[model samples]
Each structure stands twice: as structure tokens, then as C-alpha cells.
Target: MPTTSSARLAALTVAAVCSAASTVVLSAPAHAQSVRVHDIQGTTRISPYAGRQVADVTGIVTGVRSYGSSKGFWMQDPSPDADPATSEGVFVFTSSAPKAAVGDAVTVSGTVTEYVPGGTSSGNQSLTEITRPKVTVVSSGNPVPAAVTVDAASVPGRYAPDGDSAANGSVNGLPLRPDRYALDFYESLEGMNVRVADVRVVGATDPYTELWVTVKPDENRNRRGGTVYGSYAAQNTGRLQIQSLGRAADFPEANVGDTLAGATAGPLDYNQYGGYTLVARELGALESGGLHRETTRAQLRGELAVATYNVENLDPSDDTFAAHAEAIVRHLSSPDIVSLEEIQDNSGATDDGTVAADETVGRLIDAIVAAGGPRYDWRGVDPADKTDGGEPGGNIRQVFLFNPGRVSFTDRPGGDATTATGVTEVRGKAALTVSPGRVDPADPAWANSRKPLAGEFVFRGRTVVVVANHFNSKGGDQGLTSQYQPPARGSETQRHLQAKAVNTFVRQILDVQKNADVVVLGDINDFEFSTTTRILEGDGELWSAVKSLPRSERYSYVYQGNSQALDQILVSPSIRRGDGVEYDSVHLNAEFHDQISDHDPQVLRFRP
Candidate 1:
């Protein structure tokens, strides 16, 4: 006969056991390792630390919050770091409305995932890596019980009041407890069931899908022997998450974070060799989608190519058109679609006292063609530059130039104001139309990006979409960080917004286009993982051309100590590996110390 306190604890213990048994399995990128998706030796059942998965973080629900249709509950250190590790508060969302709040400890297990750019406020950036939210609730704490401390290292492998010991451990990625980054202060929680806070995903792509959680100082790092747990719901993706569970704790319950005397979840299932195996389902999704693989061409086969370059403030000559034309020529080369960002209204004040919106494109075309490629008859520029370049009440920054024999104009170009939600207007980021040759709406994504410019192109009987863009730069009137899923503080707001815009535009436009094959080339002004770039990866179906480049050739520009993919050539799923398309980034500009425009040129070749 147990006392009232004992009975309550028993109930909690049962819930915890059940919660741990359930884990959700979803499609995502993987770690650079080949974690065997099986059980470990002598562990008797399944092992939770073998899969690229998440944990069922259960703790007192200290508080709750609201954000439009999405809401969240707060929890004190969900997973305590092994030592010296900092623990951020954990926030769990149910639906659009939060169910718990400060002091109301709860347990949730769901797939851990990255934030999509579409839902961001400051737009999107490439600064922050990834973040995950709570999707499922295993149990709710009324006045979320205070967490109990467990020193598994000093105490022993299986320390418990009743000789029942459990813990968790990690080989790679998990902070070694002495780090100053997010996971510092925690060695590893091998077996014990400890709640973690501020849980988020770090890596993407197929093999680097890793989860990072903020730990509390008192978190358990022991090696527990039982079924492990974690998850992030599919429908919830980055927002609503429900912790994974197996069989709703069949036994009695236990107190929050308490060292159980004889608690154990049965039939553990391990995968990937990490600390957790995903349960089959979580949150509102019975299933979800994963990476889609397709075959591409092996070689370019020497086809003529086209591309764009964003020459930042390309005013070459002091003699207006002559100097402007000459100075710009220093950075010029051969390409199809050459984009200009920051060209003077006048080629240097033009001949007439009035800088007739500087016909930079028209002149550059003459020089580049005179410089010789195939033919330079066609031309396309944004803001139309008829009035000499001032953007009315704004400034002119983006314009495009295409060789007539190489490509033709679509004339469906337009601009909009820049914001977290859509592309920029006022010359910040603009889009123009052109025909790659197929001359048909191969896909609906001819236009995509924060300030994307779309056009139609025909390649060897196959119609496709080509989008050119000049996104907001790292230097602009944007915040340090947008109010989005990324918790990174380093990336600028405008950068993030542009990233989100690219991501949202892709997912919203290309993802839905049935037969559309989309490709985007632009100066995103961000590094590979910058929050802005992340949106492109997380949401948009865009794949980086850099991935195809060797490490030495991966970088397009250099700034500060970091070399980034500021300029990129991305393609959608459908046209990923078409027969005749060839992609590459040409070094026409940039290197922290090198010459050329602040950016280089990216070229693509396909039969038209």
C-alpha cells in the first residue's frame, strides 16, 4: 500500500515509461555517420540512441504563450546539461493555441525539425542553423514539478533510489560539456530520461540531420537501459510537435525528473546508433514527405551558356558613359544574362545634364558584345532606367542584361516592396522576364526569390523557368534577426527576409507546379548556412550548384573571415538532372582582396 505521494509518483512513472516507448520516424537529412539502426549489445531490448531522431522532453509546464494560430508552453531546462552547460527554456506548442504555461511541466515527443522560411517575420536569413518545437504531450504537470538533480557520473551507471538506473549518451555532435556554444556544460545524458530545452535541429541535407538541445546544469547523463524517445510532428514540422511514445506508460506513474526506484520502459528499439529511435507517428500527421532524388546529366557537352552578375555600383569612367563603360568592362566577361545592381542613373551623369536613368545595360551590352561572345543583340534592364536611374522616392539597385541572340525578353517584369512576407520593390530586388529558348511556361516558377525575376526558356524541346534575382544585402535597412524560427542573432534581418522569401517562393510556387522545372541564379548576399540561405534549403526545392563544385571552387565571394555562397545557381526538383543543362559559377568578380564586381557571375548551359 503506497502513500498518496507514492501513488502520484507511480502514475507519473507510468506515463514517462509509455512516453519513452513511442518515437516518430520521419524523412530528413542524416549525420555524416552510418549509425546502425539496431540495438546495442547487453542492453537486452532496443536502444534509443541509434537513430537520427529526437527525444520526448517531459518536464513541468512552467508557462504558455500565443503567436497567431500557433501557441507554445514554456518549461524549465528540459534536458539538463551534463555540466557547466547552459539551459534555455523549452517551449512546446500544441496547435495554434498553447495548452500549458509557466510551472506546468509537461512531456512531449515528436520529430525535431528546422524552421521553414514562410513563417518568419524578419523574412529569412542564413545565420541561424535549425530549431525544433514540441509536437506531442505525454503528460502534463499541474504546477509543473521542480526538476530533480542526478549526478550519474559520480553516483554510478544506473543510479536510482530503487537500484533502477537509466541514462543517455552521444558520440558526436553533442557538446562535450565544456563548450561555450549552445550545448556547453553537458558531457552527455546516456540512459536517464531528462528533459531538454530550446531543442533545435542543426544540420540538414540527407546525412547531417542532427538535433541540438539546451541543457540544465543538473541534467542526467547516465546510461539508462530502456526504450528511448523523441520526435517532431510532420504537419507541425517546425511549429507544433508531439513527443513520440510507444505504449502510453502501462505501469504506474512517477514524479517529474525523479530518480525512479524500479522504472523501465519495455522493448527498446534503437536506430542510427545515436541515443534515440523515432516512433512511427507523432502529432497530427500519420505520415510525411521526404527528400526526392532524381538523376542529372554527367557533362555539359560544350553548350553555349547564359548567366547574370550583380556589379555593385559599376561606374567605371569619369567620362560618364566612356569611363563608366570602361570601368565596368574591367569586371565584364562573357555570359548570357548579366545582372547589374547599383548602376548609376547616368553612365556617369550621362551626356545631357540630366542623368537619363543611366542606360548602363545598353552600353554594357555594346561593350561586352564588342568584346565578343556569340551575339549581343538582346538587352533587358530593370527600372527601365529611362529617367536616368533615381527610383522616384527610392534608389535603383537591380537590373538585368541579356544577349539577344542568346536570350529574348519576356516583358512581364514588375517590382514590389521588400518585406519578410514578399519580394522587394523600389529597386531593392527586382525581376524581369526572358526566354531561355523553350519559350514556354515549363513550370510556374519562372519567377522566385525574395525579389525574384522569372522568365520562360526552351531547352532541346523541354520548356523551363529561369528566375534571376538580386536579394537584399547584408548591408541594408533590416534587423539583426527576423522574428522567425531561427534563434540565431548573428544574421541580419534583411538577409533572413530574403532567405525566407526565396524559400517561400519556391515552396509556394515550384513545389506545387506539377511539371515545372525551376532554376534561380542570383546574388543572395549570404553564406551557405546563413538564415537567408537556410530558408532556400529548408523550404524551397532549390539545390545549390556549389554542391556540384569542388571544395576549392565552392566559394563565390570572400568577406571578413568567412567565404560565402553570396551568388548561387539553384534548380528545382523536376529539372534537377535534365539531359542538356550544364551549370557552373564563373569567376568574373570578387575575393576579399581580388578584383571584379563585389560578386562574380554564374553561368548555365542547356540546349535551346
Candidate 2:
């Protein structure tokens, strides 16, 4: 359940007071008529009796949430209605700690209100709840409603039906179609006790005591036991999030490919973060799948290994420097050059107008040497204070780390935070006007976002232009379970513009020297098949090397049970057609319970 704001809670309280006052003024006894729980939860996503007062709604308490600001209790009628479209259960909001307990038969009288989680603008479906409840204990120790089994067989293959075209593409008005759509199937069982048997974990447990599992064990199963999200049409309906109703510290820590042995029963809930979740009253025992981290083979002596890694907001104060250094040294096999994203300023997030990162980069270099790796030299242009869109005051930016023994950074001088770098001809060949410079930093597309960092490096006497990027994130996009069918992706507009800017820069370098050895890599923050990638690979100027791998092995990140790609490495035609190139999406993180970073690194080795 999503936390209701104090303002919204006050509004609800006022409305409840007004409704109670109306009941007192009406002389007719018909206003106090009783109704079933299914009547409150109508066939549609919203309640037909919303904002109206109902009396003597009876049910057995199946679950009680005694924690958090959204304190509530779920109750279900043992004798369900004949219609499958209507749910037999509903949640009663108590504002404070709920006094109801499991197995208690109670008669609740309250105003039926449709509360939208995350507010109405968020596109989330509304939860049918009874607010400002007046409860009457009818009996004690009554049997709780039998839990409904929700497995692959119970959920539909189709994700959702297209919304009614006349209603602005919204499915809120459409009747429930539980047999055809998975979203509707879950909606039909809202606030009801549900159970899943022997589910496989697809998302690792996080600090919030939440993890995701898939009921369909084989749905797009990869070799590492994660479900691959290939396309928008395939939303992977079997994936569901699980949270315990018990103590947060008691929740089992689980990784991808692990198993929840036996039945984990709970009430189906709709929350802000994850749509349909099981707040488990009976959590299953964790069984390890014996999954282990993978290490890539060392790069050949004659090959130049380039890698991209998003060290999730690395700062000098962080304790994971040793762990990250070990990952780069052992798991990634010490690449010749690495594009590190999210390196914070010296005073990490203090916001005192500090924009330098010499201390931060120096610490990482020292840690790498301590971990038995090469002594690396770095190059990067720090962004204006708070100009980059990240943790405010962190001043996150991209930096390149190259082993000085294997590669040399070409220093051209005169590159600053706001200065735009351009391509120029030097000795009848392509070269950067400013070696470590920003690409179109003043453009509106990069406003409040990390600008692309372009640098010149000489590997084995051959010049290579490397552009590191970290695009704007998907912050305002509607989620997969949005009430609006085929939810809108508003964040892609900015990313598409950002991609065009980089593509034009890449084209400029190729225009001067068509056979230039250019390596464009970093956390692109978009899928390999997205429009952003299409724009980056425009007119055969470049091609993403990640596509060379098998579709099941292309992902570098996992979210909500879907293994998908957000980090990529693209190369020019010269490098693509060069003497043999090897690409590996090293699986060192993103699938474990304890992760140093949320993103796995990608390494590409080729002869320049």
C-alpha cells in the first residue's frame, strides 16, 4: 500500500466527516443498508459505490499491516460471489495502527473510497478501500478465507487489452477481463489472500526488503535463470514482487535463480513502487540456487580492451572502493581502458560550490594499485556545480581511466566544463581540437544532464577517439502496470535528442577521417533496439557491438525480473571490420543479493 500524504489524509477525513454528517441528517433508514465486500469492489477497476457510505460490510480479517504510514487491514468474505469479475475482498484503511487481527469476524461500516496510489497523475490504478471505518466484532477465531493459488496457469498470457480508443487510451473504464489479461487477473484478486508455490527469484532482494519472482519458471529463461525482456509487447506477465508482512530484518536475502520453497501466501496489493505485490503473511523458506559471479578472460596482449562501468555514484567516502577495484582487476580482467560513470566531486554531495574530482579519482587509482592492478591515469572535465542531473551536490560526471603502460592519453589542452569540443584535421588525419573535452555541453539536450566526454588516446601507436556518455534517466515515464494501456514513455524524447547530438559529433569525426578508429561506449541508458540506438547508429556511421552477442546474453542490467540492456559499446566501421573483435557483458553484479554496483560492466577488445 502506498503512503497517503497528510494533506490527502486530511481531505479524506473531511470527506468522511461530511458523509457521516449526511447520514445523521437523513431520516430514512435506507441509508444504513448493508452490502457485501464484492459490492464495494465492483467489476471494474474502481468501485461503483465510491464516496458513498455503506453499513454492515462483513468479512474475516486475512491480513493486518501494523507498520508504516499506510496502516490497514485486509479482509475477505469466505462465501464469495458467483461472478469471477468481482473480488471477494477489500482493504480497510485505519490511518493509525489497525486493531483487527487474523481470524476475527467483523462488520465494518465506512465510506467506500477509491484511493489512487502515488496520486492520480501517476497513472497507477486506484485501490478500493473503506476509509474512516467503524468496526463491530461479530465473532472471534473464525477461519480466514482459503488462499487462491496464483501460478502460471492462473495468470493469462496476454499482458493487457488495448484501452478504449474513445477514452484517451485508458483501461480504467473497461470491465474486468480476467481470463484474457494478466493485469486484469491480478486486479480481480486485489486485497485477497493469494499463494504461489516454488517460485523462482528473478530480482535480487534490496535494502527495502523487497524482491521479485516469476511464477512461470521458463518464461524467456536465460542460462543464468533470469527472464529476458526482449520487447515492449512481451511484458513478462509472470513476474510479481514479494514483500513480507513480518519484520523487515527477518526477510530472507535472496539472489536471482534462488527459490522460495513451498507456499508463500499473502494478500494481493497495489503499491506505488510495484503494482501488484504479495505482502506475504506466510513467507516461504529460501533455497539457494548456487549462483556465482562470473569473471571474463584476460584480454590478449595484442588487443586493446575497452570497458564501460557505472559505479553507482562513487565517492571518496565510500567503503566499496576496494570491492570495485577487485571487480575491475579480477572480474573484468584489467581492461586497457575503462569509461567510469558517476564519479562524484571531491566534497561528495556537500554542495559548497566544489566541482573538482582529483581526490576522488586519485583514491580509485590507489585502490586499483593496492588490489594488484595497473597504475592508471585519468582524464575528465568536471561539470558545473549541480549542473549534472544526479544526487544534488554530488556533481557526477564521466571519467576515462587508461593504463599508462599500455595506452597514452593525447593532451591537446583548453577543455573546460562549458566548452564544446569539435573535430579538426591534424597532419591530414582526424583529431580532437581539445582532447579531454565536452561534446556540445551548452546544448539544451544536455541541460541538467551529464554531457558526453570525448578524449583522444594512442593505443599501440594508433589513434582512437573515445566518447563516454551517461544519458538522462527514465524518471517521468509511466510504469508497465499503469492504468493507461501501453503506458507513455515521456523520458525518451530527451534521450532521442541527446542521441542525435552524439551521432552528429561522431559523423563530424568520420567526415574528416572516414576510417577513424572511434569507440563510443558508456551507460547509454537505453536499450540496444530503442530509437536512441537507431539514431546513434545512423547511416552506417557506427554499430553497437553488443548486438554481436546472442540475444539472451546482451543485457547488462536487470530490473523487476527482466534482464535487459541499458549499457552499450558502439564502434566505427573501421573497428567493426578490423582483425577480430571480442565483446563480453561481464556478469559480476546485478544478480546478487549483495552488489557493489547495480550495473554490470561491458568489455570490448579489438586491434586498432
Per-candidate clashes come to: 143, 0
lDDT tens readout by residue for model 1, 337-398: 55555555454434333333345556665655454433454322333223222323123444
Give the candidate number with the greatest TM-score.
2
Query: How well does model 2 score by local distance difference test?
Result: 0.88
Candidate RMSDs in order: 21.6, 4.0
lDDT of 2 by residue, 452-472 (tens): 999999988899999999999
Q: Worst 10-residue stretch by lDDT in candidate 1?
A: 225-234
> How good is model 2 by TM-score?
0.95
Off by over 4 Å in 1: 1-304, 316-333, 347-358, 374-394, 412-450, 459-461, 476-491, 507-513, 538-540, 580-582, 592-594, 606-608
Q: Tell me, by lDDT, which candidate is best.
A: 2
Each candidate's TM vs. the true structure? 0.39, 0.95
Cα deviation of 60, candidate 1, in Å:
61
